[model samples]
Target chain A: EDQVTQSPEALRLQEGESSSLNCSYTVSGLRGLFWYRQDPGKGPEFLFTLYSAGEEKEKERLKATLTKKESFLHITAPKPEDSATYLCAVQEAKSSYKLIFGSGTRLLVRP
Target chain B: SAVISQKPSRDICQRGTSLTIQCQVDSQVTMMFWYRQQPGQSLTLIATANQGSEATYESGFVIDKFPISRPNLTFSTLTVSNMSPEDSSIYLCSVEDTREQYFGPGTRLTVT
Candidate 1:
């Protein structure tokens, strides 16, 4: 069965702190790995998509790196406004666009 | 790139009642998807709505329980039947273009 596991169910970091969230997945083959940020009482916002092993993508303060079996989302100098639940999902080789998501890591940044 | 919008941002309904959530995209999209996000949980795909075909439901979801309609390439609706406390969740609609997807704001449903 294809499954996704995310570590550190909840995380707290002070403003300007940097950390990384991990997502390990078990599947036949990883077609694509996605990262999304979701705010409370709203929908998920798109972040980045990594397609192959050794691939990495970055946005202002967020960087996502992928490997054969796991992906990491690294936050650099995160601010309180960047606090939200970060979700990691993967698309299996057989499925075209359907996604299997991890439970997600809730991050809180205090100022 | 697409901008998806959903209607009835939030609602409170009595048990056994039904509610319909609508999704609209600015540009025509090839596929639209409906998802359910329970409190503190990851998004669960409910169904995939195509332009001129029956919606394909995922495991644990049924057509009778959750009806979906895609009359055009840019619009769709998902109706939750027989609401229960478990049905209290945020329903989101997403549109796909190639590989990237854009999501709507979502509709918050509370069953009491």
Candidate 2:
């Protein structure tokens, strides 16, 4: 079975604090790993797509790195605006583009 | 990225009533999907709306309970039939562009 798990279900960080959220997956064949940020009362916004191990992507204060069995979303000097539920999903190589998502990690950056 | 929009951002309906949600994408897309997000839960795909064909429902989901219609490449609708309190959730529409998927604002439904 394909499954995705995210650790540290909830995190409270002071403004300018740095932390990393973890996503571990067990899939038949890894096709793609995606990260999304969802705010209250809004839908998810795309963040990054990591396709292979050792791949990394960054945007402003956020950086995402991938490994064979897991992925990490690192937030550097996060601000209050960066507070949101971060979601992780994985696509199986043999499946028809369907995504299996994790429970998500809620981060609160207090100012 | 494709921009998606859903109608009725939030609604409160009584049990036994039905509600239909519409989804429109900025550009034509080959694949569209409907998902349900329960409070504090991750998104679960309800069905895949294929243009000019019957929608493909996921396991544990049926067409009679949640009917989907894909009239064209950029528009689709999902109707939640015989609503119940357990059906209260955020319904989202997503479109696949190339290798990535983009979601709409979502419809927040509250059933009484």
Evaluate all candidate structures by whole-model CA lDDT and list the values in order: 0.92, 0.95
Q: What TM-score would you report for chain A in candidate 2?
A: 0.98
Q: Write the per-residue lDDT of candidate 2 for residues B12-94, one digit (tens) a residue.
A: 99999999999999999999999999998999999999999999998999999999999999999999999999999999999
Error of 1 at B65 (Å): 0.9
Fnat scores for every prediction: 0.70, 0.63
**What range of 10 consecutive residues in model 2 chain B has the weakest lDDT sum?**
B94-103
lDDT of 1 at B29: 91
DockQ of 2: 0.82
As for candidate 2, its clashing pairs are none
